[model samples]
Each structure stands twice: as C-alpha cells, then as structure tokens.
Target chain A: MTKIAKTSPESVRTVACIGAGVIGGGWVAHFLGRGYQVVAWDPAPDAEQKLRSLVDSAWPALERLGLAEGASKDNLTVAPTLAEAVAGADFVQESAPERLDLKADLLAEIDAALPEGVVVGSSTSGYSMSEMQVKAADPSRLVVGHPFNPPYLVPLVEVVGGEKSEQWAVDWASEFYRLAGKSVITMDQELPGFIGNRIQEAAWREALHMVAEGEATVAQIDQAMTDGPGLRWAFHGPCTTFHLAGGEGGMAHMLDHFGPSLKAPWTRLEAPELTTELRDRMVEQTDEVVDGRSTAELIAQRDRRMIAIMRALEEVEREEAAERGEGQA
Target chain B: MTKIAKTSPESVRTVACIGAGVIGGGWVAHFLGRGYQVVAWDPAPDAEQKLRSLVDSAWPALERLGLAEGASKDNLTVAPTLAEAVAGADFVQESAPERLDLKADLLAEIDAALPEGVVVGSSTSGYSMSEMQVKAADPSRLVVGHPFNPPYLVPLVEVVGGEKSEQWAVDWASEFYRLAGKSVITMDQELPGFIGNRIQEAAWREALHMVAEGEATVAQIDQAMTDGPGLRWAFHGPCTTFHLAGGEGGMAHMLDHFGPSLKAPWTRLEAPELTTELRDRMVEQTDEVVDGRSTAELIAQRDRRMIAIMRALEEVEREEAAERGEGQA
Candidate 1:
C-alpha cells in the first residue's frame, strides 16, 4: 500500500521544485507568491541564475494578482542538487524536459530521496503519469499535475493518477493544488493529453491546416479566435456557448439542430504534416506578427492581458453570486 | 458586369434582415443599436413578437456596451413580406435555416426584390456563398458575412465572396462590417465553415468525443477551457499563444520543440456518431450542469460575462497603446 503525507494539504509550507526551466520557474514563482518556501534545482549550468531571472520577471504580475501573506522572493532557495531540494519538502513538483527516460530517471531519483508519504506531482503536458512512474520506487505517490504555460497566472491545473497510483495520493494532490489557489479538474482515468490539451490541440491543428492550405493567414486565424469564439470561451466553454446559441431549447435543441452538420467535412480531421515548406511558412508568418518584438516583450504583454481577463472573470462571478444573494464563488 | 451600389458602404442607411430566428434577431438588434433603421421579415407567424423579444433582451447588453448615436429599438420595423423588407435597403443580411436549396432559393428571391447592386450578406453558418449564390440573379453582389452567435456582442465577422462573387462586393461588405463596429476577417477563399467555425468546430468535436467516451463530463471540459486556454485566447490566439509558450525561443522554437507531438493521438480526429444514446447522455449531463436555469437566464449571464471580458481586453489594448505612445488600436 502507498503511504499518505502526514502534513495536511492546507498546512503544506515547503515545496521542492525540480528541473527549473520555464514551467519549473513559473511554479517556483507561484509557490513563492503563495507564501510557501520553495527549494528549486535544475541540471543546467546557469539554472540558478536563469531561474532567479524568470522569478524576478514574474514577480510584478504576481504582485498585481495580490500575493499571499508573507509571500516574498526571499523565501525561495536555489538548492545545490535534486536530493537536497526534495529532502525537506512536504511536497515535490518535477518539471523536467519532456524526454521520457530523463523524466523517469528524475522521478526515481526524487522518489529515492524524498521522505516517505510525500506526494510528487509532475508538470508534464504530454506523457501520462503511468509512463513516468514505471522507474520510480514509490510510483504509488506520483501523480500528474499538468498545468498550462506560465502556471503562475493560468489558474487551471489538471490532476490525475496513473495506473499504479493510489486514490489517496490523487486526492491529496488535488486538494493540495486547490489549497495552493488553483482551479483543478481531477480525472479518474489516464487519457492522452487529458481535457484541455485534447481540445486545444484540435483547434491548433485546424489553425495549422488553414495556414498550410492558404485558406487563411496566421494573423486572420488568430483574429478569428480572439474576436469571436475566444471571447465566448473566456466565460463559457464550447458546450455551454452552443447551449446558449440554441436559445430556448438548450443542449437538446443544439444537438438536434447541428448534430448532422457534424458529419460535414468542415474541419480537416487529420493533422497536417509539418513539412519543411509548412514549417517555414509558419515560422515566417509568426515572425511577421512578432515583428521585431522580443519574446520577453511578448511574455510581458501576454501576462498583463491574462491578468486583466482573469480579474474581469472574477468580477463577473462575484456579481453573479451577489445577484444570487450568495457570497463570492 | 454587375452594377455597384450607388450609395457607398460608409453611407449605408436602412438595412434589411431576412429570417428572424436567433441569428437574424441578433443582427436586427446589432443594426438598430448601431443607429441604423432596420427592416426585418420572417415567414413564421410569431416572428415579429419573437424578434422583438430577442432585441429587447439583447438591448441591455448593447446599452452596457454604449449604443451608437440615436440608437433605438423603436427604429426596428417588421415588414409584412420579404419583398417589402428588401425593397428600399442599402444592405441585406439573410439568416435563414441551413438548407442549401432553401438558402439558394431565398437568395434568388432577395436578389430579384432588392435594388440592382446592393450587397447581400448571408449569415449561413455552414453553406458557403458559392452554394447559396447559385440561383441568385446578382450572384456577384452576394457574400458571406458570417457572425458568431449573438452578433450584437461578439465582434468577429468573417466576410468572403463566392466563386462568382466580384472582388468589389467582398471589399464593400468587409468594409461595411468593419464600419458597423465589428472585427472583420476577409477571406480570399471559402473553406468549409470559414475561419472561426472551422477552428471552433474542431474544438467542439473533441469535446463530443470526450463526452461520448466518458473521459470527461460536460462541466469538466468547459471548466478546463474557461480556466486554461480560453483565458489566454481572450487576448492572443492559438498560434501566438504557442509562440509565447516557447519562452525566449518564440514560435520558431515552439514549432521545432512541440510540432512533432502534433502526430500524437491526443485528439480524436474523427467526429463521434451522434447516436440516440450519446445524444441522451449529452442532454442529461448538460441539464445537470445547467441545473434548471432557463435559456434566457443563461443568455443574460453569457452576455454579461462576454461584455466584461471584451472590456477587459479593450483596457489591455489601450494600456499597451499608451505604453507605445500611440493611438488606440
């Protein structure tokens, strides 16, 4: 049987973040902003300096979102090694590169080093927890805690257990993520790409198809989303948006009305090949849009816009709750 | 050669709206709110009352968005016949049901009734203008002005001419839609579903697959979006988003890094069969999430949320422009 963490999810104080790149650094920023001590380690030669730089860049956005009590950049530590990082942590988050062998070796190393019953959550966007846990000693405690990019700002964290994972560990990770101020969706089974990625990948593939076929330019595709469905998606998901579109009939009417059209060859079902021509076209078009702006500048722009949208959503939810004569949701 | 409208698109005054269901009524409301006299017609007996009700319901949202000068719901008139509706209009928008034969016949009727060169925009979600313009007398003047649901709120309008459609007509319709306060995307070719729907239909198909396979509930899929990519999408579209996700590397790096994973079977490529059982499950699950809220209530809620997000995006754009020492974008 797998052991459970002794510390309750709400009481977790120190978190170990392994392999601090973009996702890991974002996690460091998030944990530090939430008033927890974060110990981070990465194998890159200048990882400590780069991680600090990433955190420093993310600090202003976190401040705008309102930091937790006692949250400070000083609370973060650059551990000398992976073992040192996980030795005293109540929880561990591994954000290594997406290579399967590297991820498995890292998880096993962390498993061997961590105290018994400590939960380990991996920030893998693709691989299933089951695939990564095969090499770990305490595979039962490892869970997938997939998050969107810039995890410090995006609120969603999908929590799911592997085939060897214990339900208690899954529940523990889910609770811990929620307690860390995240909107979490816990899934029972291991599905490839999970929920968000599956839907998003489909959309992305469609965009690629359009660009490949010259049906629309990159700017036009992006504009189509931001101006149209993307706005609705900010508040409502695809299903609910369609439900509202049905007017008086709701989902039943929506399915009955548009279901047959689903068979129409509107969307290119197969993924487009990333041929050299396609790749060059995409890169060139994207460069045109980026248009001399540095990635750092784009990141800053993206973070600001995300914060504004999130605040707007929060306000909407609060108003709706108030209208319902209830407290904040 | 087809004659061009005597009145420039910038000077279009009275507008004709054919078919007064959800899409048509939304158009009526949008035109009226934009301070244009609106003539509407639908063959159904209760068309006038329903159209009026829909316009009335959408009015609050338009008011919140700041209606144009002299905008008034009282300016809308429901004509007794289709000919009357199109007789004196400078522009016509046909929002009939999605049957190709019905649409072609209706466009032909509208073409015969209207002035020689007034551009006609079809709000058909599925059929392209090429198919709908087949029987029309002035096919050159017919174009697709596909708007997302609730055209009064969502700013995206995709404009494209049919195979026989003149470039001049497409340009005029695109410019006119932009003038009417929409973010317009002018497509050179008519791909199935145009820009927004193609991308959106891809995402929606993935959702249906998840529900049909029992991988996720309706609520979970929706939550994944609202809390994740949907938020990012409010400001940046999918292509730019992945570019941002590439960190210091930008899109060139992103395509190189994650482009290979496009082949991963993360998304179910094929659309699910909409069997009776799947339909029942979808309706039942949606009902559970909706929790007995009337469609009108849902629409009101959706509108409030969309307005809030759009305003938030506008604020971000304004701040960015100010930072750049430029006028508002």
Candidate 2:
C-alpha cells in the first residue's frame, strides 16, 4: 500500500456517521477502511444490517485499492441515538434525508452533543451550507462536505463553507477527507449541486430536451456520451478535452473552429419540466438499457470497474516515475 | 473475446481515407484492424511515415481486443493523391482539415474519383453535412461519421445525414462502423459538436466561468470531475447517475431534490468570452494538473484504462448470463 500522506491512526480515532442510508453506509465503509472506528445512527429498522451488507460487499474492491485499513467488521458500532453516535467522536458526517427542516433539527440536536472543535460535515446534494448550519452551536465548525455516492470508490468530496464557517474548519475537513483517500475540492461559496451536479444538470437538461424534441432516443443520447465525450471527459476534463479538440493551437483553435455555433439556440436552457410522459419515457428507457441487472449487481460491477481504473492509473504513475528516474540518471 | 456480429467483408473491402492526419490515421488503423484494405492520402511529405508509426503503435491494442483480424502492416497503403486513394474504394472517410472550403474541394474530388455507390463519410466535428455534400457528384451518398479520437478504442461514432442522403446509406454506414467495433449514434441534424461536444462545451463553459470568477483553480475543478461524477459516469451516463443520485426514486427523486436549484444563476451562460487572461490561466492550470504527461502517454493510459473497464463490464455480463442459464435449468 502507498503510504497515505498527513494521516495518523491517532488523528481520526472515532468517526460518527448520522443516517445509515445508501450514502451514509458508503461513508461508514470509507471511514472504516481508512482505519477509523465508525459510530453510526439511523432510526430505521435493519439499518445496521443493511449498512453491514453494503460494507461487506464493498470490502474486496476497497482492499484491492489499499483502502481497507487496520479494522475488522467488529470495529464498527451502531449507536441507538444521534447523541450516542457522536459522543467522543473526532468527526461527524450527516447524510440525513434532504429536507432542510429535518437537517436543521438534526444539526441542533447534534450541535448540543458534539465536543468543541469537532467538524460536522453534510452530504447534501443541493442545500446551502448557510441554511444547514443555522442551528449549529458553533456554525464555524460546520462545513458542507458533499461526497459522490459510493464514497468508498468515488474520490470527489466538494468542501464548502457557510457564512460563519471557519477557514480552519474547511482545511481540517479537507485534510481529513484526503486522509480518507478522497479528492477534495473547496468551493468559494456554496452553490446548488456545487460543481458536479450543476454540470450534470446542464447535460441532463440538454439530453432531456433532445428526447422531448424527438431528435434522439434516450438510448442514442446515452450512447453518444458514454462512447464519446464521456470517455474523454473521464480522463481529460471538459476544458482540457476541448483544448485538445482545437488541435495543436489548443483552445484558440477550438474556439475559432466552433465558436460561432455556441450562439445557436440548440441548448435547451429551459429545464424540461418533467411531465409524466417524459418521466415514463426516462424510466422505460433506463429499464431497457439496464434490464436483467439488479441494483446490487450494477453497483458491484461499477465498483469492480472503478477498482480496475484506479489500478491502471497507479500503473501509469509507476511507469512515469520509472521513466523520470531513468531520465535523471 | 465476445463474439462480434459478423459483417460481410465484401461490403467494405477497401476504405479510402482522405488527409492522413491524426484522425485519418486513426481511421486507417481502425479499418485495417477490421480486415479492410485502407488507402490513405495526405499532402505532407512524411505523412506515410507518420501514419505507419501511428498504426504500429495502435496495432498491439487492436490485437488485444481481437480487432487486428490478423492483418499485416502492408494492409494500409498511402496513395500519392486524393484521386489515387479513392480509386476502387468501397467507402471513403474524409478527415481533411476542418475548413469548409477545404472540405468542399476535397469532397468534390473524392466524389469524382470514387466509383458509383461508394459511401462517403466526413470526420467533421460540426460542419453541416448538407453543406459539405453540396458539391458532391451524388450528394445523397455523403454522410457525417464523426468518431472520437483514438477511434479504434472509443466506440462512439456520430452518424448524421445530409439533406440528400438516403436512409440506406446511413444504415449501411452505421452497420459498417458497428462491425469495426464502434457504437453508433444517429443525429437528426448536423448541429455544432453534435451531441457529445455540445454537452461537453456546456460543462466547459461553466468550468471556465468558475475559474474566471475565482471560485476554484483549474486543478481543483478538474479534480472535482475526475474524482466525482467522472468516476461514476464511466459506468453510467449523467442522467442515469443523477437518477441514482435521487436514491431509490430515481430521476423523479433527483429532480425533486435538485430541481429548485435550476433557477439559481450559478453557471455563467456566457463565460467571460475566454479573454487572454482566462486562456493563459486555463493553459497554466491544465499544465499543473497534467504535469508534463505527453499526449501519447495520456492516450496510452486512456486506452489501457478503457480496455480494463470494458473487460470488467464483459465479466459482469458473463456472470449475469450464467445466472440466467442456471435459473432456467
């Protein structure tokens, strides 16, 4: 295993996970994999069993990536209440239902129980950090640490600060997430969907428009992205990929080549108000594409492929390092 | 290797590639890999050597994918001129410069040289197919068959038809590309960047705006995508991923959770017009993130990762097939 930077066993001894849903379960797996004892709370019956099952299924890929650390399943504990989950915890991750009222109420409860200086992070997809931290005792200690689903595999965690959020809190959260093997991006200010969701929404908006307009089927549009820009964007980002599209001259050439078309009214900025017909179409199309695959099977397949990609990247990095050494010699 | 649907070799025995640049060379490699004789033309003095080197480097990967079809290097021939390249060709793929006038002249030349019933496809990124085919001998035969870079690896090919293009021509072209191990998406009309580039451009526009607004650095923004949605998106499209984002309810739940945020003016529809300052910042930031990785190295890394991912998907498919068979028994 590559030595994780700036992390120590003592730095994050106990982590609290509030809400043991799909996202929360993923967080638990990630924290446990990184050698932290996880304390989780969820009012739902069978939450523990569900989370355990997810963690068990996720372990092999995590182990392959050196993500599983010095802990076993026995190290994870289920807290009967929120306070119990957070007591003596170094960090708390909240993945409650997305209602602001529910989140605010939970924050108040959690704030009263949290030890001073402990960082509280939210797994919010669209809620503002300012709103979520309104009821916190020390709002400065609360930060929005929005992670992509299946956090054990996906590396992104968008770290944002509320109006009262302290710089140290953001830095500490960022550092902690990095220690947990996540790629952290600190936002200047909290925005809807942070960065990833907004981009996703824009693309979705256009795709929905195409489908609505009868220009293409859901399958065709999906294939175009997966087989084309999605593949490129997976490795090189949209900006860099476009810069390459411009050929040797880079973005300048690209802009010159395709700039005029940017003004075209083809982009349906108006969000497709999801009519029942559209919704049914989407569900039907998705079913067709993913037929015969259960959610568990799809997730497992996704995890394995993610592991393979990460391993390939590691191999590339190793080769580059060797080449650099040879050049130096 | 999965059993590929056989395409009769007689239908596309000889492929004529005009302008043996990067894209054209990719076509040459793809066709030759699929057991088609490829005749190519380029004005550059060393075009033949360059194409040869590209094909040689690409061959091993093609062989691994069962795409090389046991063809020799000599299967790809460089003709002295456009006329010579198109002579006796079954299908002609024009990858000449993106300039409209250049394409106009080249298409006319190709149309005049190729025998009757030969399908002519353009590798134009966004030029209208109707406009490009305006001067062709039989404009109905012209179609846009744009493939993403490293075409042999990436499966997406956008097939758009000219105003005069026949349904049979489009279907034939689609089948031919699929036979060469590509996934085809048909476009109703030729719009700028077609489906993939336009969607990508939307994301890039926002990324640039964020950078210009000082919301995040280029590296941070790039990391956000690579570590976040980019990872999941490799397995599923944006819409599908977002549908999963809604948790159990799918797109409806996702929309309800995030739909309100669509009205927020977070993304700059007009990205500060990509000023010189922004351009320099973009280039510098991209360099930092890429850290001196050569284009060839990046391409190889991309190819390696893609192959690994496809193999993993294949495994999942096989397992599912086995399970279905067992259930039936």
Candidate 3:
C-alpha cells in the first residue's frame, strides 16, 4: 500500500469554514489555533461576531491544551460570500444545517470556487458523505469528517468517504486531522451516525426504553452511564471496557459469565416508540436534572475538564515516549 | 417531610479498608486524601508496601484535582488483621476477592470489630448487600457501595440497600462518599451490576453482538463510543444528551423522530446468548485489539484523563460558587 502524504497545518496556509454556526466556529478555532489562516462564511448577520466570540472564548482552553500553537484572531477573516471563503483555501469544512437540500446547494456553490486540491468536508451529524457529495461537481473531493461538538477540545473526528470520495481524499483528510491534533477514525463505509453516533443511539435507545417501561427513571438511567460505563468509555472506549469486563478471560469470559442475561425478554428493547408523552417526560426530567445550567456554563465546564484531560494524556504520552526513547538508547 | 440530615464526611474520622487489593488501595487513597485516617487489612506480607506504592502514585493525580487535601502515608496504617483494622473505624469498606463464601467469612470477622454507628459497605460489583450481610450479626448495618475501578479518581459510588440494610446506613454512606468528593447515586433495591454496571452491561451485550455479527471491528465499536456519545457523555449524562437530541422538541421530539428506528430488526437488543464460540471470539478480538497494554498502564491512562476531567468540573463548580457568592453580596 502506498502511504499518502499528510497535510500539515503549516503546509495548508489557508482554510475555509462554511456556515459559521456553533460547529463552524469550532472549526475556525481549531484551524486558526493550529496556525492556518481561516476564511469563514455564514449568511447570519451576527455570524461573524458569534464566530469571533466563540473562537475567543475557546482560545484559553486551546492554549491550555497546547492547541493554540499558531493561533491569533488576525489569522481569521470572515468572507462576505461562500465563493470568497473557498478562494485560495487548501481545506474547507462545511458546518451547514443538517437539511440535505441546504447541504447540496452549499456544496455546489463551494465546489464551483474550491481550489483543485482543496479537501471539502462536512460536520453533518446524520448525513452520509455519499448523500452530501451527490450534488458536488467534483464529488471525489468530498469527505465526511464529522467531529464531536466543541471540536477544539474533543479529540475524536470520524473520517468517512463517499462512493465518489477518492481513497486519497480520506487518507489526506486523516493526515490533516492528525497534524491538527485530533484523533481520527477512518470509517470503511459511510453509515448513519457513522461509528460513534450509532453506538450512542443504541445506548440511548435502550435507555429510553427503560424509561418508557417505567423500569428506570431518567435520572437512574443517566446515572448508570455516568457512574458506570461513561467513566470508562471516556478513556478506554466500549470495546476495551467490555474486554476488561471479561476479566482474565477477556471479552470471552465476560460473555460466558453474562451472555445468558442478554437473552432476557426484560430488555424492553421494544421501548414504546418515543411517543410525544415520552418526549415530554424526558424533557421535563432532563430540565429537572440540569435545572438552570446555561449553555455557556455547560460549555465552559466541558472545556475546562477537556483541557485537564488532554493535559494529563499529554503527560502520560510524554512519559511513555521518554521511556521508549530510554529503551532505544 | 422531616428533612434528613445530609450525610457529610465530617463525622468520618477513620475508614477501614478490608482486603488491600487494587480497589481497596483506591479506597485508602480517597479516604486519606479527604482527611480520614485509613486502616487497611490484608494477609499478604507486602500489603503495606503495595498499598503505599499505590497511594503514592495516586497522590499526584489527586493533588492535581485538589482531591488530595490531607493525604499522607502517615495517615494510612496497615493492620495485622481484619479485626484490628475495624477496631476504631467509622466506616468499613470491603474489597475482598469476589468469592461469596470468602466475603461472607470475612464480613463476620469485620462485623465483630466494627465500632458502633460505623457503616459497613462492600465494594462488590454485582453481589447483593443481602448476600454479603447474610453472615453479619446485624445485617441492617451492611450496604453495597460499589465504586468504579480506581475509586480515588472516578467520583461515582453506587449506594445500594439490601432487604436488611437500614436507611440510616445508606444515608450515612452516601454522606461519607459525598464528603470524600464522590458522586453518590442510591439504588432503592439491589440489582445485578447495580445502576451503572447494569446499563453498561446492556450496552456491552449489544456491542458484543455487533462484534460477533461482524457489523464493526473492535476499534470501530470503541470509536463509536469515544468519538460519539462518549464525548457528550463525558460532560452530560445520557438523559440530558437525549434531551438535547430532541432539539426544540426536547426529549419528546427526539422520541418522535428516532422512536420508529427502535423497532427496527437491526436493533441488536436480541443479543445471542453468550455461547462458548461467541465468548472465544470476544476474547480473541479484544486481545488482538488491546495488543499488550498492561492493566496498570490502561488504568493509569484512565486515571490521568479522569483527574483532568474532575479538575475541570471542580473549576466550573468553583466559578459557579464564586458567581453565586458575588450575587449574594
């Protein structure tokens, strides 16, 4: 297999963020923090100010995590139009709303002005790359590089390619993300929610079922994840955690011990389809749980913790690297 | 309704850690860090040294999170016997090997020496409090307080009651954990894996099914959590995330939109019973995925990230508290 050359942020001097919403601002923060000049476009009248504020607020966290290596507000500029945003850009990230029509229209406009080698990606949560690339003039250049929210802090970015997306595009995008300090997972095929969302959806489905059946309360279900697998999943991921659950036998042992339980009809897997009643119950329950916590407060809390986690990880990585270096010496 | 006095750590002067294994060592670190004198008991000749090393390693991470307030080796004493360990203890935490008979036998010894008013809690992951207390002189004194691995870092501690466990025991244990800066979720009754473990089991069961069916690789399954819900879950619990998923419709909208998908045949809720073949596959896949990472290495990584997250949460809490204080002024 031929190794594809990765794009370093330094090498990609210019980038564009299309549809400067919450996620788009994250893209700007991430790109600008890594030292790439960003040209962002959003039709919203307050888009520029919103993006600026978001980027500015995220900077301290970015700097704390060493993500602000080459960042400065001067490196970011708001383009009046989408065509102008894609002009001279090596990378373009679309954070448009999740409507398929809106995405297709935006991508078509983007494709018309996109540089020959520019890799255009979307931050769409549920849309497949195949669907998004269908309307693109050069669909081969499109990739699905969906990132978790507050992207500058969360390391995960799912990299997927459409049928029209070239292998090189996937490889190149993966490398670009790696250089930008994001953990990249390249999907073999595009699936709804890709890998992360699917798993989350699965878990969420089961949790909702539990609530629908009155077997567990909303707080009980949430507590189960946070106090249990949530803690482990944040660091190790589900596969590894289950692997550990297997004990000395690994996943096999875990399966042998608890496999019988999985067949229990009690799973409530058929959770009464989320009726309006259930939805109201869930909202009321959640509001009661979060109480008056604002989005800003939540975001700040999230960023502070994420930085701390990243720093600790960096320390561990450094120590491991030093040990490896010592061993080699 | 008479207000129950909130359980606080102020009254907990001594904590006896029964069975000085990894989990027990974690208990010692948390108790001592929170200013309680920790008395540990184990039959191993090097129990003292092992406990000391674990405590020492835990201190830096704990200190980083502002959790290691009064931590000191001098505050930790290794007892020659279980009886000696609980002589003056205000709380007894048993982390003995997961053998029912062994636990039963040990509890009898521990119960004989526990000071009056002290809460006796087991760290058993799935065992019922009734089972552990079956051998106790006063079963009402026993409670199930299961902490996630490396209890010193992960804040969740599931406080469950058996048929015999008194309300006061649960309340006192909850308060003690809160004072130690742990998040406490009380289960009204005993269930296998309590709250966190059972939900995790549900997810894991499905994850195993996915792997067995070859729907995804170990890495893919793991990524699904880390990159997707895992990221959201690190900050907000599952219920809140779903509530957000509902968007404007909140949980009700989310249920309405995604509820139909719940009944899909693709839902892995009907997991195959853990046949021997499936178990082997799980083990083989996990080993292949994990490569050769040691438990300690994996745990250290987990601890490092957890500390970072907790520290971040603490900062947010501090900020919120400061804001509230200023508003009052």
The regions of model 2 sitting more than 4 angstroms off are: A1-10, A60-67, A251-329, B1-10, B44-46, B56-67, B188-191, B252-329
Interface RMSD of each candidate, angstroms, one decimal: 12.7, 12.7, 12.6
Model 1 chain B worst lDDT run, 10 consecutive residues: B278-287
* Count of backbone clashes, every candidate in sequence: 0, 0, 5
TM-score of chain B of 3: 0.78
Better of 1 and 2 by TM-score: 1
Question: Across residues B1-329, which tens digit of lDDT does each residue of candidate 1 receive?
Answer: 46667579889999999999989998999999999999999999999998998888778667766699999999999999999999999999999988999999999999999888799999988888988899977799999999987788778999999999999899999999999998999998888889898899889888777765668777788889988889778756787676556555555556656666877888966433333443333334333444565543543453355446656866888988988899767
lDDT ranking from best to worst?
1, 2, 3
lDDT tens per residue, model 2, B1-329: 11221233246778888888878888888888888888999999999999998788677656655564556668888888788888878888989988888898888888887777777889987587887887877777788999887666667889988887876677778778877667888777767667876666667656655554446555665667766666555545665555455554444555555555555554544222233443333334333433465543433343344334444444545665677785321
- List candidate 1 stretches off by more than 4 Å: A270-329, B270-329
The CAPRI-style docking tier of model 1 reads acceptable
Model 2 reproduced share of reference interface contacts: 0.35
Per-residue lDDT of model 2, residues A42-153, tens digit only: 9999999998987886675556556554766677999998888998798899999889999988987887888777888999876888988887777777889998777776
Report how far off residue B164 is in candidate 3 (Å).
Answer: 2.3
Instruction: Assign candidate 3 its CAPRI class.
Output: incorrect
**Candidate 2 residue-wise lDDT at A112:** 89
CA lDDT of each candidate? 0.81, 0.69, 0.68
Which residue ranges in model 3 land beyond 4 Å of their true spot?
A: A1-11, A41-88, A101-117, A135-137, A206-235, A238-329, B1-11, B32-88, B100-117, B131-137, B202-234, B240-329
What digit string (tens of lDDT, one per residue) describes model 1 on residues A1-329?
34757688988999999989989998999999999999999989999999998898778667766799999999999999889999999999999999999999999999999998899999998799999999988899999999987788778999999999999899999999999988999998999999999999889888776665657767787789887888768756786666655555555556656657777777876434333443333334334444565533543453355446656866878988988899767
Report the lDDT of model 3 for residue A148. 72
